[model samples]
Target: MARKGGELEAFIAFLGGLLAAGLAALAMAGIGLAVRPTPALKSAALVTLGAIWLTVTTTVYLRIKPRSS
Candidate 1:
């Protein structure tokens, strides 16, 4: 039977987006770190920000799930 999308799917999507963003940030960090010492700070900042966002995303997902029957 077909099923309507639910919070789980939303959570999964949110996680995927977070992961993609983190990967992009990491790549940028690598490139930046390669360029100059100043960019290294930006690199660390972005990676940390991305990790924080990922943690928030997971927390939100836990909040969204309803109690199981």
Candidate 2:
């Protein structure tokens, strides 16, 4: 049905966006390591960034409209 097709399209788009954001977050974490020379600081920064990214992605995915269908 048309509704199912639309839902599928929205789901696919959501997945694509999630993938892109994940990649970007990883790149940012890698860059963060270079910004902080101390090992402790680097670890902390990466962990914080990872946690924030996971939280944001989960929230966005949950709020995606297609799933409501």
Candidate 3:
């Protein structure tokens, strides 16, 4: 059954995105700390993580949101 898009759906998507992005960021931080990654590597990682977060969040939000007729 198709569900109507509303505040609840948006909230769920936001929450899911946060969880996914947060975990990934934590993992990257852990690895960076453990290995003492180079500055260049660190910069790259930050950029990558930012991209991942944005992409995941936007994608989730869009996917969860129903299109208007």
Candidate 4:
């Protein structure tokens, strides 16, 4: 069975992408932190990865489905 469309589906998809990207970014951060164990550098890496992931994922989603309204 598939989920019905409407706002809920879009919202869920958006959240899923964000969560996926966030997790990816966190994993990268963990690797960096493990190697150097630095606060600033780790923060930066996480932020950069998360931003990139979010941007790319959102862009892809938008391309797949434009504005709902």
Candidate 5:
């Protein structure tokens, strides 16, 4: 069904990616803030979480996005 409407499919994928990434970021931030570790540890934790978030988001986006014909 999605294959027939390429542009619309792509747009949907874009929105999905944005939503997924945003939610992931918020979750990570909440976790980091809730823990309230030492400054150095907090920095390291947030950085690690951010990297994981980016990787997951990009993977999702690529998996959902349609390829050019």
Candidate 6:
């Protein structure tokens, strides 16, 4: 039972990280578009920002641990 609860908590944390990463990516993309007027530069900026966001999110998710109860 305790193991199951821990798994559930981890799953929830993972989902939350995913949602946060997605929202952040959208915001970054918008900023990239506004900052870079040229199409190529905008695309590059968006991709770079997206990759960075994903990497950070994944690292954070992996570091999350269930609390003792």
TM-score, every prediction: 0.47, 0.47, 0.67, 0.49, 0.47, 0.49
lDDT of each: 0.69, 0.62, 0.80, 0.68, 0.65, 0.66
Task: Judge candidate 2 against the unseen true structure and give its global Cα lDDT, from 0 to 1.
Answer: 0.62
Error of 6 at 69 (Å): 5.2
Q: What is the Cα-based lDDT of residue 15 in candidate 1?
A: 81
Q: Is candidate 4 or candidate 5 better by TM-score?
A: 4
Model 3 pairs in collision:
none
State how far residue 54 of model 3 sits from its true place (Å). Answer: 0.9
**TM-score of the candidate numbered 4?**
0.49
- Candidate 5: lDDT over CA atoms? 0.65
lDDT of 5 by residue, 7-30 (tens): 665566556656766776687678
Local error of candidate 2 at residue 24 (angstroms): 0.1
lDDT of each residue in 1-69, candidate 6, tens digit only:
556345755666666666766787787677766775687866876676567656765666567765565
For candidate 3, which ten residues in a row score worst on lDDT?
1-10
What's model 1's overall lDDT? Answer: 0.69
Q: Which lDDT tens digits does candidate 2 get at residues 1-69?
A: 435434655565566556756776787678776785577866776676566656655565556545543
The residue ranges of model 4 lying beyond 4 angstroms of the native Cα positions read 1-9, 66-69
- Candidate 3 TM-score, C-alpha based: 0.67
In candidate 4, which residue pairs clash? Answer: none
In model 5, what is the error at residue 57, expressed in angstroms?
A: 0.8
